[model samples]
Target chain A: MKRVLMRGNEAIAEAAIRSGLKCYFCYPITPQGELVEYMARELPKRGGVFLQAESEVAAINMVYGAAAAGVRTMTSSSSPGISLKQEGISYIAMARLPCVIVNMMRGGPGLGNIAPAQGDYFQATKGGGHGDYRLIVLAPSSVPEAAELVGLAFDLSDRYRVPAMILADGMIGQMMEPVALPEPVDPAEIPPRPWAVTGAKGRPKNVISSFDLEPEGLRRMNLVLQETYREIERNEVRWEEVETEDAELLLVAYGTMGRIAKTVVRLAREEGLPVGLLRPITLWPFPYGPIRALAERVKAVLTVELSAGQMWEDVRLAVEGRTETPFYGELGGVVPSPGRILEEVRRYVR
Target chain B: MSVELAIPRGYTRVFSRPAALSEAGFTYCPGCHHGIITRLVAEAIDELGILERTVGIAPVGCAVFLDRFFNCDFVQAAHGRACAVATGIKRARPDLVVFTYQGDGDLAAIGTAETVHAANRGENITVIFVNNGIYGMTGGEMAPTTLPGQRTVTTPRGREPRSHGYPLKISEMLAQLDGPAYITRQAVFDYPHIVKAKRAILKAFRNQLEGKGFSLVEILSTCPTNWRMSPVEAGRWVAEEVSRFYPLGDLKDTG
Candidate 1:
């Protein structure tokens, strides 16, 4: 497809439609409103269902329903709205249903500001809702990447029967960039979901449920989910490394903070500093292996984010005291300029 | 006296389990109305010949295990979210039949917003609202539909309107909306009421088949074990006491 300038939210919506999204349900929230509007206008024209639900709770449940019916479905929201969706997300996870969810993160603890933030790292990577379940969390750094990751999210979610999420921020959601959108996926080419509750015609009935009153049965189900997650961890860890060959200082970030760190890397390199960037694309099955390997050779790792060092905790776990791990973060939806981040890199780079 | 009669010639079977229902025994407590309601729904499905393409959304209450007793496909939704789930199913595959089986707490309390909005949107789906006055599976907790002075585990002091608030008549409230095509409050307290309740359930499914939009049948049922009463007493309570607060008749039918 030809490259076209599109807002991050519009690009994601277009990408999801191309990825064979048959049902899209959402409620309006800031920083992601354009995504909903795009789906409302474009999805129906392409023969898909677009429903603006009564609330975030209802929207996620609608996604649950559509996914259970063996269709590619999705829902998007900002922070507080995402919190309301946690319960339904947990249900979808337990049922082993495949669906895509996009969270254009804004400031939060309670109804936080509409500015872009990376505060939902813990909620996205870790199990936000109650249960021993994990979603395939993908972090995208730019408009094009955000659009591309939506397709990957759907594919991984369907392949594993596990829900996948696009963990972006308002910065990416609102920013406009030229993107060569992915080719539309043929709905007929999608894999069959035999377990989905389509109907009982010509076969035994299919039941999509998370309720197992028996303790032993529930335990076995959890074990199966754990095994699938382990397989995903083995095969799906993704990251991007920039000039890490002979660098002594490493900068680790993702999403909006990641793109900013890329700029910091360029400026630091010009100033005779050996600073490399390690950006994780998948936040759940985080790129712990590559970070651990690089930490052994580097003098220190500086973690940058838009929150109070949420992902920094994961970096520390990967480094495991093998090297010094410094952290720099800007909370409350503040986006630090590359000049400010380069100064932080100057302190750590030998 | 136990007597075994020989099979008479030309004797025809009149009633049996609905084909849409599985042969498995129900998990409901004795005299609980879920079994009867389930049978009615299954009969409706069978009568309409939609068993092959019908999808049922089971709620989180006693009917949580509803998948086991149904021959058709079933999706067990979270507590109070069946209506939203049903909307998803029906919207995604309009040719399929979708229905939600929800209890009072699931429908009138936690899921009030989902139920009301789905009905208000006039989503083409069938909703079986089983109002048993109290939460059965959760041990007789006070439901939104719990009558005043009705003693439940949460309302042991005899529900006072000042603190506990009044019973929520959801069917009437939903009937006031323009979305729902058919909204009715029925009862299964006696033989005649049971027959009428079956007809109401059948109509709800039929309305969905005719593409008339959202149809909900609120069947006033008995929860004997949770109500701390015998089967007969519980049925009597639903007929005499519960029926007074929640009138048993069609609130609206847009046919």
Candidate 2:
């Protein structure tokens, strides 16, 4: 019921605290340090644990420990930092524990710069770490959505017992926006976890491990995980179909790019052109069905990204040859202006 | 008269599986010293009566099987991250006793930062380190703790200090730190050594139980399979050779 103007990083941190985040551990990286700073200042007052770990690797593993102890846990990092945390993230996935990871992404391919970029779309959607595993990834276009998704990330992580990532970019993390914060969910509303390692008091020992020596056992575990993934895909595909009815042109985007595409659509429409937009919210389960069905009606689809065609591949696959798919992007954190996106749209429509 | 009044106290069961050591059978290489050290830690936990409230973090090396062996609530960490995980568990719930069982590769090599920082912060937790001088699970690779001139799969020509650098004396190094409440290096080769190692382990655990902060016991263990020797010969080597590079005793003890 409270309305406030907050930065995306601050919104995420405050929302996590409200969501009953019992432990927050991370190292500071640009674009996302506000989240860590906020958590460090606030979590202690809430009787929660806050630690600035030695490294990204250590931070993720700390989340693993606290999550295993049956508490809400999280960590935030940038591109390079996230790269360092891949091993721990993989282990957390293998261990099947619920935790939230925020990647306020910066330009990369190797320390590209501390600026906005969507280069990590592949890393977030696809498996960044080793093995057959998936992280639930949500991309938010606004500060309010960023705050809302933090709560959703925790709920989805707890519901599925999997790690959920809030894939925000540098622009969203640093930009200020007006937002009405959601009411914090009560801890009692969270699903019960009998499997957490609290203590062995009168109960059989609980072993949380990713080590399965036998191939049969390991393969069976992957299959079970895949089954859960299938359930997630079936139930959790979220997207926005903006004015798609009777549109001759379709533009696909997400995160900061999604906002830019919205302006491009309005510009194209004002110029007497029929253009629409499809914005994906969940990056992993990529709203593929919606994109495919939309492609069936639209004349052509073009994907706009802040990186050199990272999420474009998924866009191509989702369209499935129903129409020609073109891509527009700027690498090294050079975000395209709406005018530039409108030009790309004009090439395909009217 | 003493025997007549007390019904022979020795007749009572003196030794059994500690409540911390679970019913699961440990599957380690024959003669590997990890099993012995695992039991010592469990025995320490049992003797202190902290088994009900203790949380054990297992490593990713040969000792990863600790998750199965230790009966208390356990979480398995990625290679070399056990100390960081234990730090998290302890900080979140100080009421819960937390400890980590780590191998040389996991502790001194890959996880050196986590190990050192956790210690430097004076975290109230226990660490059980097994320095076998080789990476046993990965089939005898060179470890950070491998002795000088020691032969391993990665160092077929023997460890050359010029290229490979000298073996890391992690225990000695950690002993110099100001954060540790207790630091010791013990061996588990013979009966007397085993007794001393168990005692050191108990001391480390007791220190944490009293909230002393950052106690570690580095047990100079042996990997007979990796060393290409019989279990008996491995025990002898730990006594004759391993003890030279990693001496036995309390390198540093606060209490």
Candidate 3:
């Protein structure tokens, strides 16, 4: 293990390289452009492929091609760019290919702002692309978690034969923190993809696509995808429960908000307020079981986020009539500080 | 002893159930140019033995369900987004032949930014652009390729140059870039012109196979139903009037 100081975006890019990814295709967009630039420089140095695609649409399609070829490939972009990539993402999911995507989310609804925003909660966790498809969305609260999640994303994507996403925001991507890098995985040790389109040798042929128009065929495809999702939900719901042993107020947050909420929890504890934090690591296949348990004991559940009220809906669903959930958020690129959250906690607890 | 050669019975028999053609039985009217263009692209893929390795991206217009017509991997992109989707596929799998089938509206209007940038980047992919001057899928609206003085749904009384913009020259504009390996403008209104269009498409596909950069073939096609003209009149207009504004010839063939 090598400990080094790195930005969240750079750490994720380093993790992608260490995971034996051979292709990086992306177009420059704010908050995530640094990640693409890092790949453009590092991929070529390591004998991998790097391309600054024509647009977000092109970048995503390039990811589809690379993923179809069965090489570890990825793309990175901000919120607006991710919107441009929706069609390609749907096709990639439909094809059931293993690829990584990093969305360093920013404010949006149409070029809302460039700063970080958790507004993409519904888009990321609840299927941003069309049709009945879900990307395994990993929300990293810190730079180290961002790097760690990249490796996990690769593993999960390959194991499930589906696309996985590392959904961060501007804060995580822009913040600097210490990260201990894992030993690089050997490219040769990774299982070979027999179905990859690597020049089509004596084999019959390999086709990767998302078009099954026959009603029965499309229905069957959707069923298979749903089954895979169900399995994921059963096996991959991850979260961190901090100090829930004797707390009355439970805070639910993820990504950047989760990081801030941690600080708020510490401050509340110092001030003698009984507060606990539930930070979801996997946004999709969300860690609802633990949250539901916490909701039962807590007096009130406070959902903190950067968006107006995106993840609050998820929190409500998880608690579901068991508890009253009040949301606190800052809209349009305004991220709440720990001080502000602490005040809200004091009001809710009292 | 005598040697004998077996020939295929018909053109339809030559194709292997196009995976790109939708099951919806084509919403296009009789004598629509989309069917011809679809057949031409499918035939080229068949002849080149690239069906398994080909990925076709359908645009948002009438041919959005191109996945139904071609028996290869297919992706349906947003309006004017075929090029972007094709770029992703090609970049991910360099060995696979990726192409986009887009209409005038999808290519020229909403997707112009994507198209221009993809061409500029020289992504190793092919683009099959069907330019019918009018937005055929939508109700005969004026398109960027709409010729001067042409009557369209948006331009009811003969398009005025002072009000409506002049016809766009997509092939010539693309040819200006050194990155584009091939750029051609062909028509499919007649048999001879159809043959030329096929050749251009085959060349574009071959370029991608050879790792040559971006290649686009702008097919000046007819839209009799949308243009409110007889099939014969539409074909004649493409040859006599449309071709005068958007010339039917190869503008640049670097390969």
Candidate 4:
């Protein structure tokens, strides 16, 4: 283990290298460029492959290629660049190639500014790409969590043979923080992939493909993907529940907003307001069970976000008809401060 | 007495023997050039003995099922995205031979940016372009490679320069770049033309094997089904009308 003061983006690059991912392909985009730069410098030093592809479209396809070749690979970009990658991401998911994608999200719809925004919540958690595919989305609130989740992402991706996304906002990517890099996993010890395209000599040719035009064959493939997602929902639901006991108002948030909401929770506690925070780590297999449980104990569930009520929908679903759910959010890259959230908590508590 | 083994007619042992292609037969109309070009490329891959190490990207359009015929690692890319996908494969595993098979609409229209930049960056990959002057898979619509004054489903009254624009000379544009190691335009309409196309295809693949930069082979082909012409007439049209706009020859050869 090594301790280093690193920016969130650098931490992610370092963690990816430590996770035994040999290839990092990406195109430079705002806020997330540091991640690609770090990999470009560090990967070669560590005897890995790093390339600046022609565009986000190419970078993602490179990830698909490397993953199909049975090497751990990744690509990172901001919101607009990620939209360009959706096509490649769809193919990766359809092919069942295990790889990681990092979206250091910024405001969007189209080139909506470089400031941090959770506007990509739906794009990341729900399928951003076309088709009936879901990426295992993990949102990291802190630099350490961002670093730690890289390894976890590789594990989950390979285990399930599906793409995993590390959904971070600009704040998490741009902020500096202390992080202890996890111990390096031995690459030799990892299980061998029989499907890798490593020159099929003395064996049957290994084919990596996403097309099954036959209706029955396509249905079987879709069923396999669905079963894998169901397993993920059952086994990988994770969240942080803070001070839920005797709480009158429950706050649901994630990623950077959740971190800010935690501060509000602390302030509300000091003010004698009974409030709790539920931070969802896995945004896709969203920790709804814990949220619903918290909603049962509280009078109102306040869903706070940096986007215009994206995650609020999930909160409503979890607490459907069970309790009153209100949304408080800032749109177009405007992030709500802890004070604003604390005030909202006070109103909900009273 | 010693005897030499002879290969069967219309079959070459050097080619991968068409295992991945369906015996149920091709979906292409008679005289369609796509089936021939596909076979030629597949044969080249077999001759190079790189079937396992090859990753073929198939673009949206007529040849989307190229994966089904190549028997290699195949990925279907969005319309005009085969080049981008091929760039990805090449960058990820330089050891693997990555190639994209694309139609005129895919290569010259929506994917133009990707194709131009990939070549400009001197990406170590091969691009196999099939130019039939019209969108064959989409009801004979006019394409970026569609000739001036030519009529199609979209250009029923004939293509006008003021509205539809002149056909783009992609091979010439690509050949102008110093980054690309090889660029050639060939047609598969006649026996001699097929021989020329095979040589161009071989050179493009060889450049990648030699660690040379970008290479492109633009094949002037026929779309009998979409062009609403007989297979024989379509072949003749490729030789006459298409060749006049896309002249067949080596535009650049760094090697």
Point out where model 1 deviates above 4 Å: B1-10
lDDT of 2: 0.89
Q: Per-residue error at A144 for model 1, in Å?
A: 1.0
What's the DockQ of model 3?
0.28
Query: What lDDT does candidate 2 reach at residue B136?
Result: 92
Judged by lDDT relative to the true structure, which candidate is superior, 1 or 4?
A: 1
Worst 10 residues of 1 chain A by lDDT: A341-350
Angstrom error of the Cα, residue A300, model 2: value is: 0.3
What's the lDDT for residue A310 in model 2?
Answer: 85
Tens-place lDDT per residue, model 2, A59-108, is: 99898888888889999999999999899888889889999999999988
Best by DockQ: 1
Q: List each candidate's DockQ score.
A: 0.88, 0.75, 0.28, 0.42
lDDT (Cα, tens digit) per residue for candidate 4, span A1-350:
55789999999999999999888888999898789889988999998888787788878877876777688889999999999899889888988989999999998778898887899988888888889999999999999999999999999999999899999988999899999998888998555778776555556556677777699999999999999999999999989888888889988889999899899989998989989889999998898888888777789999998888889998898998799998898878888789988877777786
User: Candidate 3: deviation at residue A182, Å?
Assistant: 2.8
* lDDT assessment of candidate 3: 0.83
Clashes of each: 0, 0, 22, 0
Find the candidate with the highest TM-score and give its number: 1
Query: Residue A327 deviation, candidate 3, in Å?
Result: 3.4
Question: lDDT of model 2 at residue A216?
Answer: 98
Residue ranges of candidate 4 with Cα displaced over 4 Å: A189-191, B1-24
Worst 10 residues of 3 chain A by lDDT: A198-207
lDDT of candidate model 4 versus the reference: 0.85
